[model samples]
Structure formats: structure tokens, C-alpha cells
Target: AQSVTQLDSQVPVFEEAPVELRCNYSSSVSVYLFWYVQYPNQGLQLLLKYLSGSTLVESINGFEAEFNKSQTSFHLRKPSVHISDTAEYFCAVTSKTSYDTVIFGPGTSLSVIP
Candidate 1:
């Protein structure tokens, strides 16, 4: 099972500064990881995902996430956030290879104080 220590309840950041959201994962041999971000009053959005290969996001609004095995951490980095939008981000993972699989965590709701 993969798990994250979870970031602060609400992360405060400046508009033009870089922001990093850190998440730690358990040393599971095979797993699929995903990031879901939901802005205030909006539906859940897929920020990025790591299933088998290259961890960097190809193209997603200048947002990039990487899964590092050496450091055993997953980080979500953005060059700079231009808006002060409050968001609810969740970290989800599964220990299955197929698309239709059951998730493991109890689910987490993280708030970003932009």
C-alpha cells in the first residue's frame, strides 16, 4: 500500500512564487498513483498520474508532478501560480494494473490557501 504523510491542512503561498506540495509514498513494488485537484465549487480534476513510465506530465497548464523512487517521495511543482484560487487536492492510489480497480486509501481532502 502507498501512503502520503499529507501536507498542511491549508498551504499558504504567494502568487508569483514557486509552490511545492509534497507527498510520501510507501515502498510498494507495483502501484498506480494519481493526483486529483478540485477548485472551490468545481469538480475533481486530474492533475497528473504515474502508472508505468516517465513521471513528468506531458502538458497540463504548466503543472508538473514527478514520482521519485530514490527519495521515495512524490512532488507536485508549479512554476508559478497566477491566481489565488482555493483548491481541494486529493492523493489517490491503487495496487492494481487494470483500469477498473479498487482504491486503497480512505481518501484525503487537502485545501490550498492561495
Candidate 2:
């Protein structure tokens, strides 16, 4: 079985500031890592992924995260953010055996203030 947990339910920061959204997971076997961002009433888009190479992965937009095996964690971080970045973020994982379904965390809502 696989499960994901997001440490922070919400994060509020001023525009141009840095932010971090914590995520942790537990799984019985190997899995794929993914971070998806969802805008208002829109579907989620793949931010980044760590399949099986370097421990660190980055999204096209300046967001990055690291996959830690020992700690069993994957936390997202951004050096700077804009109001447009404000949205709901989710950390998800899919097992090698079960690629059909994705397990998602409760999700973290990022609020960027102007």
C-alpha cells in the first residue's frame, strides 16, 4: 500500500517571497514521484517528477524538490514566488505495479499576497 501526507495544509506568503510545501510518503515498494499544481477550477499539471535518476528534480517554472529515500520524504521549495503562483499543490505517488491510480495527499494551498 502507498500513502502520502502533506505536512502543511496552507502556506501564506507575500509576493516575491520564498515558500516551501512539505510532503512525505510511505510505500511498500518502488514508486514514481510527482508534484502537480492546480489553478482555480482547472486540472492539475505536472510540475516535476523523480522516476529513477538524480535525487533532485525541478519544474520548468523555478520550483524544485528532492526525493529522500532514507527519510521517505519529498518536499517542494521555491526561491521566489508571484501572485500567479497562488494555487493548490499536491504531492502524489504511483507504484510501479499500479500505474493506473495515483495516491495524493491532502494538499497544500499556497496563497501569494501582493
Candidate 3:
């Protein structure tokens, strides 16, 4: 079985500052990691994922996450954040056996302050 865990429930950052959202997971076998963002009143959007190949993955919008198999962690980071970046972020994990089902973390609410 695989499970995801988000270290923070809420994260507040000033505009134009760097931020990092921590995520950890537990699995006996190899797993695929993902990060998703949800804007207000909108569906969850895929931010980035590490399905295969390189352990590092990035999104078009400047979000990056590295999959550390040894640590069992996939932490998301951004160099600079904007107010529009504020949203709910979720970390998820899935294995080959349970590809249809993705286990998501509690979620971290990111608030950008001006």
C-alpha cells in the first residue's frame, strides 16, 4: 500500500518570494508521484509528475519537484511566487498495481500575501 503525507496544512508566503511545500510518501514498491493545484471553484489541475526516467520533474508554470526514492519524498518548490499562485496543492502517489487509484495527501493551502 502507498500513502501520501503533506507536512504543512497551510503555507503563507509573501509575493515574489521563494517557497517550498513538503510532501512524503510510504510504499513498498516503486511508485509514481504527482503534484496538483486547485484554484478557487476549479477542479484539480495536474502541476507535475514523475512517472519514469529522470527523478526531477517540472511544470510549465515554474513549479518543480524532485522524486527522492531513498527518502520517499517528492517536494515541490518555486523560485518566486505570485498572488495568483495561491491555491490548494495536493501530493499524490500511485503504484502499478493500483494505477487507477491515486492516494492524495491532506492538501496544503498556499496563500500569497502582498
Candidate 4:
């Protein structure tokens, strides 16, 4: 079984400040990790993913995440945050054998302050 967890449930950052949203996963079997963003009153959108190849993956919106196998973590980071970046972030994990079944973390709400 695979499970995901986010360290902070809420993150508040000043505009143009760097921020990081931590995500950790625990699974006996190999799995894939993904980060999704949900804007207010909107559907969740894929931010980034870590399936194979490089340990790091990035979203087009200036967000990046590194999959650390040793740490069992896939933390998302952004150098500078914009007000438009505020949203709910989810950490999802799925086993390679059971890709259809995805487990999501509690979620982290990011608030960008001006």
C-alpha cells in the first residue's frame, strides 16, 4: 500500500517570497508521486509528477519538485510566489502495480499575501 502526507496543512507566504510545500510518501512497493493544484471554486490541475527517469520534475507555472527516494519525499518548491498561485495543493501517490488506485494526502492550502 502507498500513502502520502503533507507536512503543513496551511502555508502563508508574502508575495514574491519563496515557498515550499512538503510532501512525503511511504510505500513498500515502488510508486509514483504527483502534485496537484486546485484554485478556489475550480477543479484540481496537475502541477507536477514523478514517475521515472529524472528525480526532479517541474510544472510550467514556476513550481518544481524533486523525488528523493532516500528520503521518501517529493517536496514542491517555488522561488517566488504570486497571488495567483494561492490554492489548495494535494499530494497523491499510486503504486506501479495499481496505478488506477490513487491515494491523496490531506492537502495543503497555500495563501499568497500581498
Clashes of each: 0, 0, 0, 0
* TM-score of each prediction: 0.75, 0.95, 0.96, 0.96
lDDT accuracy of residue 4 in candidate 1? 58
The reply for model 1, stretches above 4 Å from the true place, is: 99-114
Top candidate by lDDT: 3
Q: In candidate 2, which residue ranges exceed 4 Å CA deviation? A: 98-100
Q: Report lDDT (Cα) of residue 109, candidate 3.
A: 100
Error of 3 at 58 (Å): 0.7
| Per-residue accuracy of model 2 over 1-114 as CA lDDT, tens digit each | 789999899999999999989999999898898999999999999999989989999988999999999999999999999999999999999887844589999999999999
Local accuracy of candidate 4 as per-residue lDDT tens digits, 12-106: 99999999999999999888899999999999989999999999898998999999999999999999999999999999999888436999999
Candidates' RMSD to native:
3.1, 1.1, 1.0, 0.9
Q: Model 4 residue 77 lDDT?
A: 98
Per-model lDDT: 0.63, 0.94, 0.95, 0.94
- Candidate 4 residue spans exceeding 4 A from truth: none
Worst 10 residues of 3 by lDDT: 93-102
Model 2 lowest lDDT segment of ten: 93-102
Q: Give the TM-score of candidate 4.
A: 0.96
Ranking by lDDT: 3, 4, 2, 1
lDDT per residue as tens, model 1, 1-74: 44655554457677767767676667466666777777778788787888777867532667677877677666
Query: Which residue pairs overlap in candidate 4's backbone?
Result: none
